[model samples]
Target chain A: MARAATTSDVFNAVAEPRRREILTLLVVGELEVGAIVTALRLDQPSVSKHLRVLRETGLVHMRRNGRHKLYRTNAPALQPVHEWVSTFERYWSNQLSRIKERAEAKMKQSRETGTSEKES
Target chain B: MARAATTSDVFNAVAEPRRREILTLLVVGELEVGAIVTALRLDQPSVSKHLRVLRETGLVHMRRNGRHKLYRTNAPALQPVHEWVSTFERYWSNQLSRIKERAEAKMKQSRETGTSEKES
Candidate 1:
């Protein structure tokens, strides 16, 4: 029995620049396989391979529309990726405050040292 | 000369679960090499290798303090990863609206077909 792709697979799938570009293209609107190949200027086999990886990652989904398979971004699976990256938000937000405090404390120490030297 | 790690490298580096755990650990405060090894319960060599990869990826930094090398998360390097992942934000927000519209349209479509069948 085969299980559906898990969220962790998405992290590695998106590591490639070309795959990310492919995802960006799909975000605009649904397109057929031929259209993706032409737009990205990639060879058919390469584009197909990337699309397969993206599909397996569950970041994109496609459906048969007449003779064409229309593909579009499946944004829900990206939730795990977003959540994992957001974990670092706390560190990013606090960085500014930490830098400011360090600078101010250094200034205060310098001023106090000068005063003590003058007194001596 | 080898180039320093770029933002893309950080994406690949943090893709590993253990690496992400290491980053999470550093978020609280700085820790010395020995402390990180003990806290994670990983061997010194394994932790050292992970630290090297983290440093090369620019996601972590170390400064020599006496005999110990203090390590901490370099939050700024994570900026690019954050920004990249955020591009999907528009898609995520729009998904809810799209799903609602689809559901409503399906209901309306079913009612219209039912009415037409009754007329026929």
Candidate 2:
């Protein structure tokens, strides 16, 4: 199957660690391209390239402030990614393991005392 | 910078839509390679390749079941991804918008009635 273009898909665009870092930085508030480059310690061209992919995928919004360009995260664009990953939340939550541990401990105590646990 | 290998990173492993589909199917329960191939309607080799990547990334676990290999999701491995994406939850949540809407409506009502609202 053909791969989705990284510039066109939010998931693909965010797959790069640098791009993820950029999004995290923008979350603090909007920043100029030069600010992002300085904060991330990356070269101008590389940052610009990532910004373009993020802009294309709608992960970040850009605006002009006179002579400068400001960028901020368009966080709503990440909702689909968040929702899809959240579906597996139950599988990873510690609550299930905690419950299992309590049950096993109770069972062990009952076995040692030879007493049946009363149903609640 | 060099890219992380898909076989080693959960995020990259799931970037492919087909792999994401496979993981969703595994969430139902463990399935054999043949079962996954049939359920996903992909070629055997393609399914096998995807399964290998999933296993290497620890997104899925495979165990021998006599003549077959059974696969199940290693959902705990997805915690990092869930945690990372969840940081942006507040940005997309409707609660903020709802609160803003209510405040705006109240302000509009107060203006129309020519009265100040009492502080709660």
Candidate 3:
């Protein structure tokens, strides 16, 4: 089947935990199908199915190495996904900054009151 | 049905483009279901289905406002997703940096050669 060509396809493919785990594995380096199946503790067919989805999403690239098919992360294909999710970063970033500010305020209060409670 | 309680669930729910669009709409502020449906140009049932998925994933919060249920983005629920995808930022960031460097180099070469070609 032709690979997915939209944001939904990319997100849907990665929606499976197994697929995310596969991507993580590829992030470190390329691996043969056997290693991926073993790492995920899933049956060969199940792993293959997830790999097919990943391949369709362009999140992974597969190459035949002799008799084995090796899978690697297609870093470029992930750029769009990364960019898309980045729009939400401001929300998280604002929350994180708020958290930091609260922590700093607490620390300042502790310093003023001579309390030894550690503020994280 | 009870909401999903894993990373997979969140990713799966947001995987739909309609769901993401809903999120974008909610980001600015909360909206009534009718408004969302109209904005997306989808039927009420379809929009409702997407909303259910979003609500199940905890990416959206709905409250009854009079006879209508207003939907809004659950900012905290999206934190994990944002953090998860941010890991891949380094890959795109590196690529962007590489592109910038190449552009700079090309610009320098153009200057040296007295060419006026713009490099982006």
The best candidate in terms of TM-score: 2
Q: Can you write out model 1's per-residue Cα lDDT over B19-93, one digit (the tens) per residue? A: 778888987789998998888898899788888989988889999999999999887777887888788887786
Between prediction 1 and prediction 2, the one with superior TM-score is 2
TM-score pick, better of 1 and 3: 3
lDDT of 1 by residue, A60-91 (tens): 89999999899998877777878887888868
Candidate 2 positional error at A2, Å? 5.7
Instruction: Using TM-score, rank the candidates from best to worst.
Output: 2, 3, 1
Residue pairs with backbone overlap in model 1: none
Off by over 4 Å in 2: A94-120, B94-120
- Writing each residue's lDDT as its tens digit, candidate 3 over B44-88 gives 998887788788778888999899999998867776767777676
lDDT of each model, Cα atoms only?
A: 0.79, 0.88, 0.78
> What TM-score would each prediction reach against the true structure?
0.72, 0.81, 0.75
* Per-residue lDDT over A2-93 for candidate 2, one digit per residue giving the tens place of the 0 to 100 score: 56788877778878889999999997799999999999999999999999999999999999999999999989998889988999988778
- Could you tell me the lDDT of residue A70 within candidate 3? 93
Candidate 1 has a TM-score of 0.72
Q: Model 3, B1: alpha-carbon shift in Å?
A: 17
What is the per-residue lDDT of model 3 for residues A1-120, given as tens digits with 9 covering 90 to 100?
A: 322333347776776677788888887788999998888899999888778878877888899999999999876776666676777778668888998999889888988998977745
Lowest summed-lDDT stretch of 10 residues in model 3 chain A? A1-10
Please give the TM-score of chain B in predicted model 3.
0.70
